[model samples]
Target: MNQLSPNRPRASDQMWLDAALDLLVEAGVDAVKVMPLAKQLGLTRTGFYHHFRDREALLDAMIARWEDKNTGNLIDRCDAYAETICEAMFNLQDCWVDWDLFDAPLDNAIRHWARTDADLKQRLDQADNRRKTAIVAMFQRFGYEADDAEIRAMTILYTQAGYIAMEIAEAPADRIARVPAYVRLFTGQDPSRNEVERFRARHGF
Candidate 1:
């Protein structure tokens, strides 16, 4: 299990990682080489060596950053306090709208990268399973039965995965307008006006 860190990495380390991530997202992992990143950042290869031992080490760090920011924030949202299942769903949905909570582009990039790397593909599968487990637990905490919770968790997760895979785009207002209906469909219960308002407020909708 990878331990999640609350502390940010040093500024110089993050700078290299950021450049590598952009290259990864824009041109796939093949383009995220040390030479490319060094050129992109206008930094010498020596600077990269100061933070990472080699290209492979930098790649490992990239995966760690993705897992920490994306998966870590998701689990945190799943465990966020909520008085009802509707509210809880909203809390988790925060990941959909909040880039800080979920870096969907990075998630997409990593998923694509994993397609060619067996070890990374395994880690990606594990991450998905972990995310579903958290969602299932969240549902169970609100009185869902074991079987119902499992299916509900899968539905929510797979739906979002579909959105990401398809690169679906929608205006913020349009998506927010659909949230109440979506929450109802996912939870079998409509969110209260207060719960909906709170969800909107959090997203500045």
Candidate 2:
């Protein structure tokens, strides 16, 4: 009974996922419904079925995307090569400034959504644990003791999470200027002038 043209492809899953994420970031999780998403994408509801089983499936995909980008990239940055803890701190700080590497708005939205959904909250907890554990390992690699590393890791994660939660707005140049002090405070060692310059250059400051 289907007469769809073979050449015309249906909307891809990423398109649906991106639309859902936009809605979620703008209006919260309740706004991420299938009809609204299909309408936003200018695609038929029938086409959505090809990519996701149901609304819940689409939401699960959103969470997976969030974890893949935010949590996964942070871990990758933590594992990136750095000669000193300060350099490693800069590597991790790259995520704080780069939206592509870490979607702060989506992260904040997910945290808000998790408050109402117990399953999501549990998954969020697991993600936090994984992030903190990786950060602790990064510190330990630079010769920090277990307790010291754990405290520093928690400080770094919690501080950035607070910034995301509060939605603080600071100019890029201003934030970059504070990097030296931040690195020093977080790592207990001041970054060299050259290290700070390199970090700024990497961010085009």
Candidate 3:
């Protein structure tokens, strides 16, 4: 008699969420429906039901995942210890370079989805505010005035966001070459040679 393997990988809520995110990036939110995700995962709809009550429940989980992992993690990284303002800026750069942590594609997908969903738009706005507030806090830690910190934080955040939105493709070497300039422009001081070299080494440039 044929028997199912006892060790077969069972589908989890995170697996469904990951599949939904992949579909969101590949085909947009419209294609993230339960049937499509189930087909993509090679599982039946019953697997999805075990994790999510409905499509709306799955969407809510996805949004929460985005907010917690992407937004909250970035803020935490910015708050990491650094010896100087320049070092702090470099620390934040780690968030930008590490795609797995920041997930630009998913961020962009959510922004696009927010266009059609008012509630999501409001949530995005709140996330944006929290991110900016965290950045400002980072600057203030370096003794920058509140007004200065706010302006500089906005400049840094918006510039990175714009780069991701424009989808500009550049070689690793090219981007590495420009990091010092970007850090200087954002922080009003150039990163030390050690800081730059450490960054390059981190990205294998």
Candidate 4:
């Protein structure tokens, strides 16, 4: 069991949500009950009341956190300054390469949970559409027509999601070797040597 700060009166709302997310990732949504989390936090069940009204409230907060951190932050990074479509794609790649920023385990867990929950399935669908829209806008900024941009964006985003779902195990060397080709295939533009080097340096691959 994980313990909270010894000096604090109790855990914060975010702390509880973080613990819940950890359990969700490890044992699915069914394991994200208040009693287990309270036990993990070294607190009583009543302590959870200080933060969430009930399990549903906690679940709702978790989804909101996921949206803010994963969707909102990724979209913001995509909208950051990029002189070309390739650069914009690279900007998005920064999120993909850095698992810490994107939380792939949490993403996989939520997606699995959505398989049986209609409401959650709807939420996931909306998030996917929004993400694709952001990617399309990035291509449009590089002068691609709306239809072309949409198709390219879908291909890029879907391919990334497929990579995650497949859980392909490969040597880091092999994966790095494929980066240039992947960038070309996704963006329809060959990445410059400097761009590839910078990506390698950023990801240390």
Candidate 5:
């Protein structure tokens, strides 16, 4: 839908990043080389070079765009959903895991890159902090007094990351479908349905 398209002065930067992020999703980061982006966008290398200095510059641009769009914008959007802490936490977790926002191969590639790239890892750390802050706010609203926000946040993040990893594995859908139950356990929420509870216990989650 070209959702990242910016108005006027930022237009060229937006176009370049849209092409880069698209390429990253469709073909993986390694496939987002300058030549392919130019070809895909029907632009010459001269045009691309005008917007981005080089491949690393393009990735930096993409990371900036991601931080602005996902961490800054989307997190604010989450506050409009629920009132209480547990409800908000579950809802936010549910919203974040929506398939529309997740691309398994792209996710795997980003994690791989983060391992060796300190700059990208720093960016991820910022996003991670924002998420934890939001989650801690939710927990505080639920009457939890531990003040261990960072610990809770890291635990939740690790669980979500592990869940994504499990999804990418060869596990059958019937088994992987227990993710919601595991989510309930981690969030300390009681499942509304017997089936959900049964699923949690069955998975030892």
Candidate 6:
């Protein structure tokens, strides 16, 4: 298991990991080389080595940190945002849009490096499975029965990301506009009419 200090007050490793993710979002994942991250954090190569065995170790750590944050807080954050169309996602689409639009492509670019780095790819797969499982549970919360919820949620997890790719490549708003359809499909509700609207109108469709 990947150990984390999530219940603790945070550590320099955590800061380094956050800085790395910031670099990922800002300059793409290729820029997350150990040397560059160490320099960005004012650490010498020796200092960086003390924390992570190498770039692969650092990448694994980064993925672990992201999963920790996601599993711990993502659902709560969506519920707190409970008054929007995404709230119907229970708003998961809202939570991940930024990452999918930006970081996921960056992650894909990093995968080219993964072909030569077995450990990084292994960690990546672990992180990917953890995220998929969490999202599936979130769908069950939206009222799908367990087995069906897992299937529907995985469809969104694996498939809707193409919309993010298309939006990034071409017509952004049109791509985003279609996202609610995915949530509706999973929830067995129609985007054109939801419980929120039904409540507002005091009627069911």
Assess each prediction's global lDDT (C-alpha) against the native.
0.89, 0.93, 0.87, 0.84, 0.62, 0.59
**Compared with the true structure, what per-residue lDDT tens digits does model 6 show for residues 1-205?**
9464555332377767878878865676678887787667666666676677888788777666555554334444434434433354635654454443235544554445456678767865775676667666665655667898678767866665554345456444554555556656666765555643433232111
TM-score to native of every candidate shown: 0.93, 0.94, 0.93, 0.89, 0.66, 0.56
- Reference-based lDDT, residue 190, model 6: 58
- Residues 17-121 of candidate 5 have per-residue lDDT tens digits of 877887776666678898877777766676777777889888887777666655554365346455444445545544344434334444555666677788788
Q: 4 or 6: which has the higher lDDT? A: 4
Better of 4 and 5 by TM-score: 4
Predicted structure 6, TM vs. truth: 0.56
Candidate 4 wrongly placed segments (more than 4 Å): 1-10, 170-177
CA error at residue 44 for candidate 6, angstroms: 6.6
RMSD of 1: 6.6
lDDT of 5: 0.62
**Candidate numbers sorted by lDDT from highest down:** 2, 1, 3, 4, 5, 6
* Model 3 vs. true fold: TM: 0.93
| Per-candidate RMSD, Å | 6.6, 2.3, 2.1, 3.4, 7.5, 9.0
Off by over 4 Å in 1: 1-11
Please identify which of the two predictions, 3 or 4, would achieve the higher TM-score against the true structure.
Answer: 3
How far in Å is the alpha carbon of 110 misplaced in model 6?
A: 5.1
Candidate 3 off by > 4 Å: 1-9
Candidate 4 TM-score, C-alpha based: 0.89
* Superposition error at 37 for model 2 (Å): 1.0
Point out the higher-scoring one by TM-score: 4 or 6.
4
Question: Per-residue lDDT for 173 in model 6?
Answer: 53
lDDT of 3 by residue, 46-158 (tens): 77888899999999999998998889888988898988888888878877777767888889899999999999999999999999999899999989999999999899889
- Deviation from native of the Cα of residue 58 in model 6, angstroms: 3.9
